[model samples]
Target: MDEPVLEVRDLVKHYPVRNGLLRRSTGAVKAVDGVSLTLDRGKTLGLVGESGSGKSTLARVLVGIEKPTSGQVLVDGEDVTRLSQAGRKQLRRDVQMVFQDPYTSLNPRMSVGEIVGEPFAIHGITPAGGRRAAVGELLELVGLDPDHANRYPHQFSGGQRQRVGIARALALRPKILVCDEPVSALDVSVQGQVINLLEDLQEELGLSYLFVAHDLGVVRHIAHDVAVMYLGRIVEQGREAEVYDGAQHPYTQALLSAVPVPDPSVRLVAPSLVEPVETGVSTSSTSGGVGGGAIVLEGDPPSPVDPPSGCPFHTRCWLAPALPEAQPDPIPSYPPTDRPDAGLRLVPAVCETDLPALVPRPEVGSAAAPGDVPAAGPGAASHVVACHFARGLAAPRVEV
Candidate 1:
């Protein structure tokens, strides 16, 4: 493929935690820690994760709304982080954002036309004919009547207001759109309309999208590729069919199992097929050993201020330990030890000490070879994951 339209390398955004009196910096919330991905031209990359998982922060960094604590944001092979003020402004013209909330994102005091035309004014580009005509064209482009351009935000419905937001983002004629949960606030029916509109716009304009949302169903429908984020990092990413159909990471599997199945008759077999590893301790404290085909995570997500050691999700992971007794087949245990009890007690010591790299599992084999795992290079074989146990889970239990 040609060079990606957008590329992120080890992006990190950390917010300082402040305390009383002097208001000195205490610690930092690692909102986005070491995230990387690539978006090809004219394609949508759906970013899905639970709330507080840094999806929005990542989006903000991508569009230059938030500065990264470290790492690079490259647009068409140019490192945006190194760009000057004038150069940055030029970069903004190529990338625009659609915020999550339509009501708050649009200025209620301003007319729809003013809001939509603001970008053109900021860039000092008088439209081909005039501002009004250009704004009217943008309004019509998003399916809103051009006459409604004079109306205030309060006068329009939620869906219509969002359409106005879309119009504004397009005023800059950006090649890449960072849609931060654009359809989440609208009615479910309205969401379908907006998604279809986005699809049409991408086709007509040859635009790329970094669509961030928690809605898996929406992502599945619109995304050509999918990246699953957990604890401020990408756990798994690949083609939509490959990642969804054959998720390797335990976190990915757990997330997929949580997606609601509409049919009552269809049943999942993951929970029943795998035997629970007995630690000889009570499982009641931690969600009863993963119930009903769902890996019920115990406790709230770890605090970003002080995230867990090693694998961030290991604290609540049901498959943290590699006890052969845990499943029908013996899986690989970490620490490179033979004695299962030495490593499989409660928390596997290797998971607590060593961080796993995002490695590509063997294409036709079950085990990942031992070596330095490379980043997802510019190729079709970019199905990379960040877990030691992922190789054992090369095949997913259900069609996510």
Candidate 2:
């Protein structure tokens, strides 16, 4: 198999919280906590989560915008985080970023040409056909008219500004692009156009993308692989089909179930399907955590400054030691010998004591037959999940 374009291992980033007049550090907000994943060359890895789930922080860490607390960010086998100044400059050429807000990301003062060609100037490399020609080429490549390269950023629409951002990122001909919600601010109709544009650019240039976004629908469209993040860690990851269809993690399942179905008739027929999680599961029978219905997550996520001891999700986890009836049958248990923490299998005790590692589960029936499915290797058929009970309660494949 080809080498992965980007690989992150045990990536962690923390910001200190200060106090009083002296501003002494009191606590640290755990942003990107112990994240690890691999992005194969020319593939897109969609990092999805709600706000504060550390999606943006992870993207920043990958592109070298923010230094990691501790971890390895290997770009094509090179540890970029530890690279020296000159090596880091060269690294910038190999990797570029596209931010969420095109309006703010682009400079209002610079013409589209200047914005796109700034990379060449910064790297001290003259464009093949001078700066103007090179800038024009980039503009056209991102689906904008080369003639419009002389226009200011304010002259373009939201989608057009995003196209400019893409043009700028491509100017350096970077092998990897870390896109932080690049289309989040665009109009719904325009979002598809930009997404298609990105897909086209990837195929044409053989670019690998670390696309971060909150929308699963967008991720589903762009990502070849998907990694579901909770708090500050990846709870589930696998090929797009496997993760989206047979979502094992309760969080992943909840996220998928909440996606708005377009069929009006289906919504009318199964109105209960669209209702909040608490509405379905009786509160009396289900005491703690969000109930059985649709996995509606309750309460704000735990403070990152002082996250819950074992599982960060335990406080709001629907599967946590909740109602007696809602308790998972037979209880979920891992071998006492393998992990550092073992034999701690009370409803929330095990989850609270041991931070579950992302591990593969058995594939669902039919969509992938037992013998037909490939073994969990670097290639495919690897649907890694984190929650202890997710395996036994794996949701069936539901095509979007």
Candidate 3:
């Protein structure tokens, strides 16, 4: 495989919420805690999760929009973590971002041309003739008329404005585009058009993408690989098909089951995103389809500041540790010293008491050697899960 365009190793981003004038380091909200992913050159990675799952924060960190509290961010095999302000800015041209709200992302006052060409201006980039011809070409490339370059963002439709945003992102001829919920603000019909534009642009330019969205459908269509995030951590990740078709995590299973079926005859029997159809185009609860339905993890997304001690999800998890006397098969204390795989537990004792490591299940009789845990198959090597009993999860259910 070609070297990855972006590799995030145990990336953690926690925003400290301060109170009082002195600001004595109040607690930190774990926006993105321990996220590790590899995005190959020219390939797309869809990071999907609920509203507060730190998806947006992670994107900000990827492009240097926000700094990560810990972990390393490697772009093209070089660590960008320690780069100075100027260094970060230089890297920004290579890795650009398209924000979620087109209305808000674009400066309403600026003409489309200026908006699209801002990158060039910022980087002291002189496109032979001060960015005019280049801006026109960018507009045309995004499927909008070059003439519209003079218009303000307000003059265009939601979809059209989004096209302008895309044009702006492409001005620097970036190799990687970080899309943060790019289509959630558009009409459902328009979402497809924007998604198609991105696909076309990707193929034409060999661009890599870190597509951040809440929509499963959009992610399914555009992402080469996908990661399912919860709270601040990635619960499951693998090749798109492996994770989408055969989701091994209960959260994943619940998520996939929720996408509403368009067919009226196909009643949503179990708890999926769709319920009985109403006359109006029935849409699910969340802004996008994939973001909807699956039993919402209980409790508001735990405050990133001072997250729960045990497994972050355990506080809301139905399958959680209960009092030993009341518990059935008490949550198994993990990484016992007797087990060779023990040191994996670095969490506070609360998590250590009975925490789940997203380990992979070995094929029956496929253990590396006696007492050696089974090695994950090629496809599922990254398929490693974080849940304690993750290895014992039922084989993912395949729809097709």
Best by TM-score: 1
How many pairs of residues collide in each model? 0, 0, 8
Consecutive 10-residue window with the lowest summed lDDT within model 1: 264-273
RMSD (Cα, Å) for all candidates, in order, is 5.5, 6.8, 7.7
Candidate 3: tens digits of C-alpha lDDT, residues 1-400: 5568999988999877778998877788889989888899989999988788899999999999888899999998889988998899889888999999998888988999999989898999889665899998899999999988899999999999999989999988888999999999999999999999999999999999999988787898899898889888888787887677656555665566555567532221222211222221223353222334334443466777766665666555433433343334433433234434332321112333433344554342242321244544455565655554334322423343
Ranking by lDDT: 1, 2, 3
TM-scores, each model vs. reference: 0.86, 0.84, 0.82
Candidate 2 wrongly placed segments (more than 4 Å): 264-294, 323-347, 363-381
Q: What is the lDDT of residue 71 in candidate 1?
A: 95
Clashing pairs in 1: none
> Against the true structure, candidate 2 has what lDDT?
0.76
Q: Give one digit per residue, the lDDT tens place, for model 2 in 268-319.
A: 0111111223432322223321232233566778888888877677666555
What lDDT score goes with residue 38 in model 2? 93
